[model samples]
Target: MDRRAFLTAKKSKQPASVKPLPLEGRTSTGLAVYTGAWTKSEITHLLKRTMFGARIDDINYFAAKTMGEAVDELLNPVAALPNPPLKDYDGVTGAATPDNDVANGATWINSVNNDGTIQSRRRASFKKWWMGCLLQQDRSIREKMTLFWHNHFATETVDVSNANLLYKHANLLRTKALGNFKQLVRDITLDPAMLVYLNGRSNTATAPDENYARELQELFTLGKENNPNYTEADVKAAAKILTGWRVDTTVNTFPSYFTSSRHDATTKTFSSFYNNTTVTGRTGTTAGDLELDDLLNMIFAKNVEVSRFMAKKLYRFFVHYDIDAAADANVIEPLALILRTNNWDIKPALTTLFKSEHFFDVLNRGAMIKSPIDHAVALCREWEVVFPTAAAEYADTYGMWNYIMSVAANNQQSIGDPPNVAGWPAYYQVPQYYELWVNTDTLPKRNQFSDLMIGNGYTRNGKKIVIDAVAFTKKLSNPGDPNELINELFEILFQIPLSQQVKDQLKKDFLLTGQDSDYYWTNAWNIYIASPVTANYNVVNTRLRGLFKYCMNLAEYQLA
Candidate 1:
């Protein structure tokens, strides 16, 4: 559409009707009260929760809007775009070549090489595009959903040197991330990277590898704890069913000319858990493709397994990890109902969760720690920062981000590659996962990041990255009273109302600084950016520095 027509069309769209807030008497005692229609705190909370985090500019833009309006914009973002496809490699067909020796640590490169040019370029491009997507992608839902699926169908490059195939698999996940859970599962099973990683390539008639098949049941389809319906026999049978699927290492294709010569045409049987009729067709000889489809059909026909499996995982991811009996009946069961009814349509399940009253409950807010990816992405979104242009510069920024991921990984929360195929141990209800996230090692790192960002202590090289605090102050139309400004900042940062003690501390700290409230606030932030003692040369000694130290040391800084 032309710009003029687009503007006219947008203007023509009617505003959604606003719902009145429930009365204090009708609402729960713990529910927060809003003094005005909308405030900066609410906007900040929405941004932080919906995106990664919010910047001062982000808070200012939506501060005056109602919660409903702000959330609507987030859930249905305008900027998010579809993931683009990777450029295909030339002269490299799907055939098993010697794995890159450097990648395998079999040979070391003293310097960059002229040979292996295509492979090197592909790897670089893949990293650049992957980071770009996280930093610059317009589609928020797609990006977020891609991250979710990346974890769901977790595969690493440790085993696969074919960068093109890896990129293809990653793109596939992004493209179908939010589309259909069933289709995604089917595609991943056949994905070349997955095929290689899970021994799908080695799954043959003589001896079928049970790795992928076992995970398909125990980890992917059913909850390891509650649903143990399938047995060892079932896994072996499923493995046999999957044999003859192999990657064409040359072109990165799959189900390569299933050698009927090498095929295990033997019929396989499973317990009552699986429909016996589905596998009966494979008696003497069956096409590999038909057998695979029958297996998927059989799995899908047992809707109970998929629904229960998906609903539980979704609950742990979006909601709290703990699932009560009542929640199972009310939230989880309903989610499963929608999933099955919609034929495993993911968006519907997500929409149901987002629209539910339970989603907006006070207890659920600030419940999750900002995962490393969450923290990095939130910072970029809030500040509207772009990735650095230079590769070395990009690497430095990525190093900082990766350092955080490493800390989380040490705490058992890596984003790209989790601990195992089962994914970050935390997703499961492991006590150690929670305990690991806040040990002595990780707490200091988390505090350091908070001090650097919120406290304003970040730097590049020897120089401090200055925040434009004066510009921020001038942007506020109504400067209002000190109390109002503090309230606004609190709302934006915390989302929930601040306790009286915390509020009083902020006021007292503001008074002690003695500069104009705005300037002091700004400089206090500058102090935060300089708190890392090893990076201390980037910041000078100042009162704001001292205050930055004080605020970051507080317990509240630990929350999302």
Candidate 2:
């Protein structure tokens, strides 16, 4: 059934089932440091934006720290980068070559294989591995920032068509998730997957491909909306400067090399927007690298435009989508200044914005519809949904991750493959913005996904991975008290606070089983606690499952 029909039926029973964001735009709270209370509400808000989901343990762990300390810990990730994608599949049938070179569970990232079927399987492996990273992310903002950078510097694995190149590109994003933005742009310019995706490899002295150059200015930096922005001539000049770069597959490292012969040696000039700056082209090996640096310098010199554009994108990703005049003046403008003042080091700016009063403001919470990946990851992480271990259950582990990737792809936020070079429309599209995530088709699928995860979950290789609702409630302060259990669950699972009336109704409908007294649930839970025998266990487990499933299916759960 469609989302409209489903939500309508749901709302008929529970009036608070479908709460949409207010038509009025977002909070006017600026980048001033917030001195407000740092309760579960604020902690949940911070974690939801920074991490996949705010697990109970994560919220409580961060609760010990002051706001600055928590933000500091989040920005500074200490974990080692995850190991590369492995060869998870058996031989691909009806193929030109076999993938038997790499062992069943060994990493295929460094191995060189040009076989189409093998590359295809490796691509699947790459996506599954990426999902695993998101699932197993540490208590830091690294994963979320990595994803933000991925969307910002989008390169499609499908278009690149090389699994090794895709893995390298992904590694670049992860390695520099919070590194210098200007350096990242430079790195991405020479990245092999980017060269393949944006036709940078084909850009030569005789013929220039304006694809990457145009995107470099329009989408990446000096955003298209800015008045007197980089001209078409500037794009052509940048493309000329970027010529001669080609992926060097002959070398073991598979890096992109500068081909001196293919480079344009003529001087390239920019428009008035860049103060008529000219990048003097040079000859020999250093020409491509030097000219490219000059081009970036010229663009980044427009620091206001570049920083503000970046701030807006970051704001949309971490905060609300809409950027009103007040938000632009109070938040985006100053945030841009912070970015520029920090010399494009992303961590400080992120640190400030995340700790600001505006971030903690009530209106800022529950302002965005969670992206498909966000929703899926949050569901698994928050619920502590179990997956098979990669060490022993290699196939099953990857199989489960692959299932999640497929579900996300179907929901329109495919990790390795966004719809286009512009990335997902939901991030940058106007009027609708994040609202694009929910629609007739995708919303029901979202609900169905949570329902499945909360219920039977997805079974892989004879192992069923689902939420252990009984065990999860056992972690609560008082599972015996129906009201406290509901309150605790709401605090963890929801961004917006539910009314006491709604909580009372939920208790009656699910835990209390329509009984007037709360002991109906309290006694059932205590009985199960005393004797976890099949009969008593079934009584509590059934109620808890129903409670969680119904809660997850609510419209509030859809918001991050």
Give candidates' CA RMSD values in order. Answer: 10.0, 6.0
TM of each candidate vs. truth: 0.74, 0.95
lDDT of 2 by residue, 1-560 (tens): 01222221111111232222233434446777777888888899999999999998898898899999999999999999988887888756756877566788889877777878888888889999999999989999999998998998888887899989999999999999999999999899999999999999999999999999999999888888888788889999999999999997645478998889999999998899999999998999899989988999999999999999999999989988878777787788888998999999998889889988777767777767889999998889998888887486888889999888888888999998878888899999888887888889998898898889877889866898888898888888788999889998999998777889999998998898989899999889888889999999889888888988888888888887
What is candidate 1's local distance difference test score?
Answer: 0.57
Candidate with best TM-score = 2
User: Once model 1 is optimally superposed onto the true structure by TM-score, how far is the C-alpha of residue 83 displaced, in angstroms?
Assistant: 7.6
Q: What local lDDT score does residue 487 receive in model 2, on the 0 to 100 scale?
A: 92
**Candidate 2 local Cα displacement, residue 326, angstroms:** 1.2
Off by over 4 Å in 2: 1-25
Tens digits of lDDT, candidate 1, 69-106: 55555555565453432332332344244234333211
Candidate 1: list runs displaced more than 4 Å: 1-50, 55-132, 137-139, 226-228, 252-262, 280-286, 383-386, 389-411, 432-435, 453-481, 511-553
**Model 1 lDDT-worst window of ten:** 1-10
What's each prediction's clash count?
24, 0
